[model samples]
Target: MKLCILCAKQRAVLKRPKTGQQICQACFYHVFETEIHHTIVDAKLFRRGERVAIGASGGKDSTVLAHVMKQLNEQYDYGLDLFLLSVDEGITGYRDDSLETVKRNQQQYELPLKIVSYGDLYGWTMDDIVREVGLKNNCTYCGVFRRQALDRGAVMLGVDHIVTGHNADDIAETVLMNIFRGDIARLGRCTEIVTQGESSIRRSKPFKYTYEKEIVMYAYFKKLDYFSTECIYSPNAYRGYARTFLKDLESVRPSAIVDIIHSGEAFEIKSTVKMPSQKTCERCGYMSSNDTCKACVLLEGLNRGLPQLGIGKESRVRKQIAESEQKELPTVVQHFSQIQRDADAPDIIQPRDPSTVYTPPPRMPTGVLDPPTKKTLDW
Candidate 1:
């Protein structure tokens, strides 16, 4: 067998996809971890004493990410208080099974784990949403809700930054998806290593440049336990087409993944383009591109028997709303800021009693009622 390319010692084991170098297991591990460390350092992804939450999905990428984040935090003296944060979308047999893996990882890595569920946060689970919306457009509710759920979970954890396991291939697929959709705004920013949410919670991808193959190899050789299952609801997602296309290109040229990311990074939007401005959601106080956040709009649709309210053109949704008889819209259970405050002092209030009756207060003249102090029917 040929010797390792880097050490010229042990026999070569596997060839890396990014560099096409044959190396031993030890060398592979060293380079894999080193490259990620460099990415973090070069991007200045963390502060010395910041509390960081790893967005653990119990999948291969996330399981590997939690292990590596803990390893690097200790080995390089990153001084980061790392925690595992997971969003429970309440998908039966899928998310439920995967969370068990995350729980085991929490124990193995000895990091604090916080799980926020859709049922608890938004009063609607994935199963329920799917049942209501059917197979079509169910992903829209999930994507919007999960994004906000993670942010809210991070806030409750009081974390300074949230890091996900989005790898090079994932980033490349996203670039292709944005280009195909002609989403100029998302296309311009999708390649960024780090992004700040409207709430100022920083999110980064430490594995932004890491290959998915390498991550799989590392997990396999290390004998790490991780869940490997496609989300049952995402079989028809548009991103799947983009992913398949990118993989085809990668089969022809291994460098296609990194090249796509670099291309996205280099592509600049013209100043004349009109980008959506960020605003605070009037309902929940979350940052949104519209007056109401997508989550709120979707929930409204679900509650009002208008599941397509946020699925298509805003003008059509408005027309539908105007055509229907006016009814009292649901009020948010709690404000985002109030939730943060409650998180800071866990004993300040008692949990809402499920037995209590919910009466929708009279609608304000402004039409946007303030968040109810008591829980709503959904809650």
Candidate 2:
């Protein structure tokens, strides 16, 4: 039996993928958690008393991340008010099942949970999307909607920052995918540990340097409840090819994942190569490189019964919209700023007199703003 390298007492349980160290379960837990703590501290991922949301999906990576984050915060006195934020894509057999696990985690972790469904936000669901645009390019709609859904959920929760479970392996796969597609702009920032959108709400990866295998190991040893099933519609994803190649490379060379991330970080775009500038979407006020955000465009395509409007080339899509008989397309019901204002407003409290009747104010008319009942506070 191999003795533990860190303690030299207990038997070694497993070999770490990031470092080829044979260590006991206790040491593995220590090093695995300590490294994440170091990453957070070194990157300044959080500030004292900041409300941070864990982008929980109930998958192994996200489950382990929530558990570790809560553990670290309590053990190290990070002074963070943590919450669980989930996006319900409305996949019947997939997301629906996983979300139950998230609910259980909410109870187990004693953290407030908020779920923002696609149907509620966009008047469509993954089921609705798949039914409209069959299997091909359906992931595009799901990806775009889910990204904005998370952002919208964060806004609703009024969190200062959001942390996702994207680990080194996921980042490595993204780096390779960007390189394969020659997306220079995305390749430039895909490996960043932190990112912020137009709303200035920060998004980060606390497990940016962690390994998938170690994450699984940590979850297993800790007996965490997580859903491990893959989305049924992901068989045809473009990223699968890059993931396969990356896994094959890792089998031969364990450090390939970290190396690819390092390479992505080291890449420098030339001054001559033009990068797309960020702009607000005219339809929904979300950040976009074009006039309309991808979510708004895709939603319009679905609503117009022309699901192919946002699928292909930009020129062709624009031409299709131009040739269409409809003079005006539907815009999002509310802008992002309005959503933020609603989220920041405090809940109305009941009057102090119990016997006295309390009549609530009539609902405001459409397109009209309500009078503030209390002093307005800025986020």
Candidate 3:
């Protein structure tokens, strides 16, 4: 029996994209699936013995990705040792609720699922971090920390490559965000299907060209178990703007998104905007362009009373910290953190009064600092 792509109903709409080759929705889905499978093979995203960890969020995109990848790998005999890697962000109702779906996914697919969480490594879950940092900064910390957590998990799993459920819409949204911010290098790198050579594990996005709507529909037709809750603290204004803009465009023109991404790959840049070289984080030894990665920097902010770690916008971090010693007063009393810090306000260095026993700051043995000589300040 033939299938319908437009509605997934038994009856067909007999329509394809206004542009491009004429194919039914079912046929289009097959095309999407075949193209994605071929893309993975052509890109050489997996090797015979190497472990591949699918970044499962228990959401639609991930659910569909895991399903499709599992099917293709076996059918094509890709020789991939597929494992599921889910990073629990620990949002009370959001992540806590969603994680159940991941657990169920393990049973449904009969794939070995490894769940790693922020609470385990950072001693702070999204819930705890949100309580201290508030909703405004929750997603920022979660996203940054989640990236690191995934890498760390892959390390523990001894996997060499990590595949995320990042679909075309997400990729399109990110591209627009980077372009709007004038981040040429990130814009160039963000579209990369496979990231290799730097981090502990290589990361790739097999669904990089798939659409979110199609993924959701695929999950629905397949009747796959998935968690359908937005993160409780997903309050990123910048990314929200990009998402809204993309959705608006998607409504007006269906192929607008895929076309945009293809153009992103196709567009040639004559300018010399080289991507900054990545170095290991001085604190955590993770791959980063700066001396310390964003994750390490945010971790420092949380330990200190710095507001900037929670808030990534330099303007807002500066505004909040201008009142007092914000995020940048050293996290060390007697030792130095490995972070190559941004310029700190100079006023905080005066030694406290001897009578007032100020507790030493969080200590990191970075080994490059002049020792703090305690010349007691007058009370």
Best by lDDT: 2
- When summed lDDT is taken over every stretch of 10 residues in candidate 1, the lowest stretch is 361-370
lDDT of 2 by residue, 144-259 (tens): 98888888888888888999999999999999999998999899999999999657899999999998878877877787878877888888898888899998998788899999
Query: RMSD in angstroms, candidate 1?
Result: 14.0
In candidate 1, list every pair of residues with a backbone clash: none
lDDT tens per residue, model 3, 232-346 = 5765656888999988887678788887787677656556756678677766667777776676667767777663653555555445546556435442211122322224211
* Model 2 stretches with alpha carbons more than 4 Å out: 340-379
TM-score of each: 0.89, 0.89, 0.76
Error of 1 at 318 (Å): 2.2
Considering lDDT, which of the candidate structures 2 and 3 is the better prediction for this target?
A: 2
* Candidate with the larger lDDT of 1 and 3: 1
Order of all candidates by lDDT, from best down to worst? 2, 1, 3
Worst lDDT 10-window in candidate 3: 361-370
User: Residue-pair clashes per candidate, as listed?
Assistant: 0, 0, 3
What's the CA error at residue 68 for candidate 3, in Å? 0.9
Give candidate 3's whole-model lDDT: 0.67
